[model samples]
Target: MRILILGGTGEASALVRGLAGSGHAVTLSLAGRTAAPKPEAVPTRIGGFGGPEGLARYLTENGVDRLVDATHPFAARISRNAAEAAAMAGVPLLAIRRPPWERQAADAWREVGSVPEAVAALGEAPLRAFLTVGRQELAAFAAAPQ
Candidate 1:
């Protein structure tokens, strides 16, 4: 059966590799939001699908028998779109999420309720900060007082 894997995460890449050399044909799609995407072991498509309509069209045109949403956990928009499109196209859909990293005893983690709270806690201390909160809140880091 032809499979379409909406992939951009490490789990996606590993899935592709694990399915590699198998008889099933797989097509992986990436959102192309990265300036430098890591290499892939399978065929890939880049960019958005315009919207649900476009996605349905693609699924119909490609004759995709199955869809696996292997995008990052935070990619809610694409996940919703994929679900909608798969339902609209009457295609089987599955979500393959990676297990989150477990904290080790040596790891010291601080949980903050909000972005502003985290920023406020930083206070006037001059220190380098790394923000990996995704692109939506990238400006928050820039706006933080140094």
Candidate 2:
């Protein structure tokens, strides 16, 4: 069976490595969002297949039998698009999501529902905050009250 893995996460690479010596045909797809996407252990293809319509078309054109979504936890757009396209094309879809890291006693965590809220929670004080959420949400802290 032809398996297309939507890979941009570590779990995806692990999956690819695990399935390394298998005879099943596997193709890993990436969105090309990064200048250098995480290296893949399996064959990879970059860029989108347009949108839902294009993905559907590709699924039909390539005879893809299965889809494995191994994208990042916050990659909602591509995940939604892939699900819609998979359903439209009548292909089986499997979400290979990684288990979220749980905060432990050794770890300090301040949980907030939104980025704006997190910024507000920081209060009007000059403080050193570690922005670990990623580059996209780092802007929220730029105008934080001092």
Specify the highest-TM-score model's number: 2
lDDT by residue (tens digit), candidate 2, 62-84: 99999889988778788998999
RMSD of 1: 2.9
Candidate 1 lDDT, tens digit per residue, 65-88? 999999988898999999999999
Clashes of each: 0, 0
lDDT for 98 in candidate 1 is 63
True-structure RMSD for candidate 2: 2.6
